[model samples]
Target: MRVFVCLFLVSVLGCSLAEGKVVSKCDLKKEFNNLPESEWPEGHTMTDNFLAKLICHVEKASEFNTSAVNQLIPKKKEEEEAEQWTLYGLFQLSDHLICSDGATPSPDRICNVTCSALVDDHIEDDISCVLNIARKVIDGGFAVERKREFWRMVKLIFQPDCNNETAGNYFAECKD
Candidate 1:
């Protein structure tokens, strides 16, 4: 009888613990779009509303920032290591470049403008190496005609290795 009672208590405690956890996707668009311009990297730029919303989606779906993966992998690794994650890098970059509340000076033309709005600042800092890879990616011929391209590159980086488990998981969860 005591064993059964203990099991019941354990089950009840587990249930309560599970119930305490919560995952929400709230005000997603506003989350990314409302990011301030000061957070943008030295050469990259983005509008508050768009960045807030994009970040919301990524935060919900991305598993890149966990320290489970090694940081030595190349930005274009073709395999997923148990010690490395992709969205973490991009998110770190995004956070350092545009999420933090600081003004990072750059050349006047750091970010190109369209329709009188900024696009990407392309800054590089120790906190986020994603910006450096992003600049290299942009230099590879993908023109930044719209903010959508940033999303695409992030997607690519997250899924650099099609056959790897992490990349596969990213594809399955994110679907590009």
Candidate 2:
């Protein structure tokens, strides 16, 4: 009985370790409620699928065929200057995911559209890092013209880093 109990405990611990933490927009809302709206970034174009596009770009750029490009674009977590990401990038990212042409999607929209998909796919990574960036960019105090400048930097980072001509097309839009 003692040996069986020990084995069960070990299995339980292992399972728990294998399961990582998950963060969602709902969680963000609960945590950041007291924050002011001006601090929020405003890049959500309503019609542009920013999140979907970014995801597709990241996924494709990270694949074996284009992994070289992925290597060139540093992971958000790895940068020492990660905290310095401008509000424009954040708003652009959020707007891409939640906006439907200036009509920002509610928390429920996020939960229904992407969160449900995340749960269904069993994705475990804390994508909230990017989401938070989006939130901050939208809510942060940066002005619209400054936001455009920030996006220019993002575009510069992607242009030379991408080896795939097709992926280059996406980066090109940033120029306009």
Across residues 2-42, which tens digit of lDDT does each residue of candidate 2 receive? Answer: 99999999997666444433333333223334344543345
User: Model 2, which residues run further than 4 Å from truth?
Assistant: 1-48, 64-126, 141-153, 157-176
Candidate 1 per-residue C-alpha lDDT over 79-147 given as tens digits, one digit per residue, 9 for 90 to 100: 854322222222333321222313333222222321111112221232133333445455553335433
TM-score of 1: 0.26
Evaluated against the true structure, the overall lDDT of model 2 is 0.35
**Lowest lDDT block of 10, candidate 2:** 64-73
lDDT scores of the candidates, listed in order: 0.34, 0.35
Best of the candidates, lDDT: 2
Estimate the TM-score for candidate 2. Answer: 0.27
